[model samples]
Target: MPRADTPGTEAAPGGRLRWWTELPLILLVYACYSAGRLLVRGDVADAVDHGLAILRVEKALHLNAEHPLNRLFTHEPWLGVPADFWYASLHYLVTPLVLVWLFRSRAVRYRAARTWLMTSTFIGLIGFTLLPTCPPRLLDAGHGFVDTMAHYSSWGWWGGEASAPRGLGGMTNQYAAMPSLHVGWALWCGVMLWRFGGTRATRVAGVLYPLVTTIVVMGTANHYFLDAVAGAAAMGAGLLLTPYVLRCARWGRTRAVARFGPAAGAFTRRLTGPGSPVAGPVTGPVAGPVAGPVVGPVVSGGCETSAGERFPRQRDERPRSGAEPDASPADTGDGAPAPAR
Candidate 1:
């Protein structure tokens, strides 16, 4: 179990979890991800070059899965329209839904899961900033890949530029495609369901969700095979680093408390006002002191006490023979009690 001071460990008073605190943290991370995509719009020429380079490598390795899948989706409207919806909607919808489910149902595992997701998202942001590659759909027409989201724009709310709503595509960066977070987030959701979700239905959904998401990303021409591979790799790296991130957070929290706890307590007391019960010294009636030592009842031999008795049971001091034992014996044992002097 994580310490209460650790990030994501506790939010509400008395170390209880609260959705209000959690929702803001999640929203902040997502906002940063969105802002990152908008800010790190790399040069179009550079992005295109990077995308073409990936294509050549995929060709050499015989991993050109995106082309055939893109072609099939392009030709079949039935498949294409739904794939666009999955691309535009489920990527945002399902991941958060799974997160909410975990928060509500699997509270014990929620912190670690949320941390892993946030860490992976930041890692994906780094990939976008460093090596922005244009997605397959954004490639030249000669590449023979169709942007299904754009092709089926009439059937959905998304615009031709990207998955963003109509007239909002300009806000999105079409070239931040080196690591597809769509697939990465889907994989995270799948793993969470598989590991923490105890039902057979949830486990099945877990397996299919990521698999179908990978297909949808490629079939929609939004990502190459390598892009999907990189996304999974980013998640793997995030999983490996989560423990260390948590440890660092724990250490920092410990230091902060050690350094500022007293001051913080004082500040809180001031805020609560001088008459606040917690800030004021405790007061009540006082009992007069006793004159001498107060002793508890003594137990005779063979008398069984409760589990946590401090003193051992005394030995029996009965007069076994005709003579009576001394009132205050020097020793009490199985042997004869000490005789009077």
Candidate 2:
């Protein structure tokens, strides 16, 4: 397909199939999921201790999940309270929905896009391993943010809790919150779409998605103020790193074109060579040089006895006779005589 007026920088993307490149991406995604599960499920030792301690210290300073403002709205007897499933659903769907949309759209550069998405996701997950901060809902059971996964019934979607149930991935890392992948991925989605979104509608969609995601995590007690900030930081890191990623992509393509371009050009040139069926200056014969004239001998072939009058063709090249010219050379013209060449 032709490119849009708002072009993508994905020009000259090589002929690799989506599936082939997607292989490593799939593996990386699974690996990230595997690692995240392990981290979330296992104990975060000093990590959580420090995280909860921060929550404690923040609590002393009136910064906590159950801050007075939060307590007012989430007053006791709030239905299906902590781990608010309704809000949590938004968090889960953000990534999946955006992925599906981009895949189905008419955008160029999806392969590079998907690769970016996958790589950034794994990198965010790796951060989850290195710095495991607890969510506000989990920081000290009483005031820790709710584990919305623990809430089943009041989900906006019926099978909501079922999402996390059946141990979606074993060893769930519930407390790895220093850099929230939830926010990081959401921010990634926001940036990717914001950068690529051509239409006003698309750009707005990109901008709103992360803002909504932030609220969902906060309302569900899944992250802290700092988690969102940390996630934003992660996004900043990814953005900084993207240029290198794109540079590698560009270098790879430069090599591929150096390898393949001349071959294709040579092939095209050969197709239009001397014997080609098409007619053009380079590939076809001229009209056998421009024709000058077509004078010829009439069938009355006679030669002169004494002298034959020869015409250097007529000045206008009309045939008068093939008979020999009169030796007398006198015309019976009453008015005038035609001039001889």
lDDT of each: 0.81, 0.56
lDDT of 1 at 149: 91
> TM-scores, in order shown?
0.76, 0.58
Can you tell me which runs of candidate 2 are displaced by over 4 Å? 4-12, 16-24, 36-42, 56-73, 76-88, 104-106, 109-112, 142-163, 166-171, 192-201, 249-341
Q: Per-residue CA lDDT of candidate 1, range 54-105, in tens?
A: 9999999999999999999999999999999998999889999998887777
Model 1, position 189, has a per-residue lDDT of 92
Candidate 2 global TM-score: 0.58
lDDT of 1 at 165: 95
